[model samples]
Target: MMHKFLMSVYKEMLLLKRDFGGLVILFIMPLVLIITITLIQDSTFKSIHETKIPVLLVDNDNGQISETVKQNLNESGSFEIVTQIDGKTINEEVAREAVFKGKFQLAIVIPEKLSKDLQLKVNQNVEKILGSFGMEDTASVAQKNIKILPKEVKLYFDPATQLTFKNAVKSAIDKMISKIETQSIYATFQDQLGENDAPLFDQKSFISFKEIVPKVNDKEIMPNSVQHNVPAWALFAIFFVVVPLSINIVKEKSQGTLIRLITNPVPYAVVILGKTATYLIICMIQFFLMVAVGVYLFPYFGLPTLDVNGKLILMSIVALFSGLAAIGFGILLGTIAKTQEQSAPFGATSVVILAAIGGVWVPVFAMPKVMQYVSHVSPMNWGLNAFYDVLLRNGGIGEILPEIILLLLFFLLTTAIAIVYDKKKREV
Candidate 1:
């Protein structure tokens, strides 16, 4: 039985070798695809964090608030504060025109007397609070009942700017302004209570935010485009094996090779296993080559290097199961298809559709809630999750076992259906 299975595997290998050009294309094209996609996506990721956007600033206030805003914007390292254009200082009108005409993506105008009005408002509120607490004279609070109008800090956005970008900028500026207002109120209270008295409260932030990610060997392994794209596109390329594998099987059937194999004394399951093993080998090769490119070649292109370090074994386990699932699907597709034309196009299109809905094109979380639920049906999603578990989450065998089991079950189910379908056809 082992000898017959080995012979079956050898036959498939020989057939693949005969179509050497197609085989080479299968390997080369995926590498090209992964590299191109990683480069494009890495640039986008860098643009959001590493690249500073140039923003027009109209500092009409030129007071404490405006100065603080300018200083903070520069310190944030996300924006380049452009105060002048053509050697002329920009005012609110010029900034507005520049942004509206798309000369700049964003413009921030600090209204005149913003600091003064904000201070007056804070002082009045503080005096009222102190009076209510019996810490200040009620007569003095009643005498200064003048209301202060709110100051407007205008923000202009380019017509072409996306709504998300606009909202992000607005949210950031609003937080900064709120912090400034809170500080001003604190300062006013201190002045009213006399600086000589013990400090009431610390003006600095009591709470802050810090991002936490998975760690390896006591060092943070931040997830980057390389870590993400390598496994994702590798799995995509792995499943793409369905195309050629299905076409080969369909070709065998049309040419009577499958009929000859069926007539042989060897069990039918051995023959199917042989084909599955051959294609699984091809899938593994594709995955490792992609990982090699991500680790070695990506850095040359100014992209982050993929670090597989200790997770190579777990990755291989996921890739092996994913390959089996793909091969099972290919075998089933070839069994059902009548010709190469039917198998080839449908195999390719189905892989693409599976990839699309499976968090390959867009993240499942980013998809609409309905689609997110729908994505669970795609085997590709299971494979991708297993890959992410190993790569990003730094998961071990125990953590990735569920997805691995799903992939294995998918392989078994599809292969069983193919065998049953073929048997029924032969009986007829």
Candidate 2:
């Protein structure tokens, strides 16, 4: 039995060697895909945290408020405030035009008399408080009847800006103005009471937030583009083996190779096992090559390095089960398909559909609730979640076992169906 299985494996190896160019393409294409995707996404990630967006600032007031806004924005390190363009200072009209033309994503127009009007408003409110307490001077009570109109600060956004970005900018500006108003009120009260008096309250924040990332051996291991793309595209490439594997089976049937093997004394299950072992090895090689690129090559391109650290064994285990699932699916496809035309396109399209719904192109959490539930049926989703568990979540064998078992069962079920289908066809 062992000898017959080895011979079957050797025959498949010979067939693969005969088509050397196809074998090379299988390895190279996925590496190219992984590198290209990682490069594109890494820049997007950096732009959010490291790149500064240029914004037009029209300081019509040029008062304390405008100066404070510019200073605060600069300190945040997120915006580059442009007060001038082409050697000319920008006004509200020019800022609006630039933003509308999409030259800048955002523009801020600080209205004239903002500082003076804000101070006047604070003064009136303080006097009103004093009058309600019966503590205002007789002369000050007469001045409280003067009404001050509210000042407006205008924000112009590019038409292409997302609504979330608009809301975030608005919230930030509102918070800044609220803080400035509170401080001005406090200062006015100090002058009214006595300059030598202690502060009314501390201005420092009492609450704060800090992000806690997953750690391994006391070192933080944050997920990055490379970590995500390597496993995802690798699994994609692994499942893509179905196309060639199915086509090869169809070719063997057409050429009478499979018929000859079935007529021999060797069991059909051994032949299937032989094919499975050969293709599983190919899938593992594809996975490790992708990991090697992430670990060794990504850093040279200024992308974050993929860190396997102590999880190599667990990752390999997941890859092995994933490969088996893909192999079983290939066997079923090849067994049912009548010709290469039927197997090739169907195999490729099914893999693509599975990948799309499997949280490969987008995260499952980002999908609509209905789609999220639908994604659970895809084998690729199972493999991807298992990979993420080992790479990002610091999961051990116990944590990954459920997914591993699912993949193994998927392999068995598909292989059984293929065997039954082949048997029924032979009897017919």
Q: In every candidate, how many clashes are there?
A: 0, 0
Question: Which stretches in model 2 have alpha-carbon errors above 4 Å?
Answer: 44-49, 136-154, 159-168, 192-196
- For residues 1-428, write the lDDT of model 1, one tens digit per residue: 89989999999999999999999999999999999999888865664558889999988897999999998899888999999999999988899888889899999999988998888788788887887888985545654677778888899999999888899899999999999999999888887887747778698788999988777679986678888899889989999999999998889889998888878876668889999999999999999999999999999999998888899999999999999999999999998999999999999999999999999989999899999999999999998999898888878999889998999999999999999998898899
Give lDDT: candidate 1, residue 327.
95
Please estimate how well model 2 matches the true structure, expressed as its whole-model Cα lDDT.
0.90
Question: Can you give the TM-score per candidate against the true fold?
Answer: 0.89, 0.89
Give residue 297's lDDT in candidate 1 (0 to 100): 98
Q: Which lDDT tens digits does candidate 2 get at residues 1-428?
A: 88999998998899889989999999999999999999888855564548788989998887889889999899877889999999999998999999999999999999998998898888888888987898776656656777888888899999999887899999999999998998888888877766546886566667778989877679886678887888899899999999989999899889998889989966778889989999999999999998899899999999998888888899999999999999999999999999999999999999999999999898899889999999999989999999999888888898899999999999999999999999899899
lDDT of 1 at 183: 92
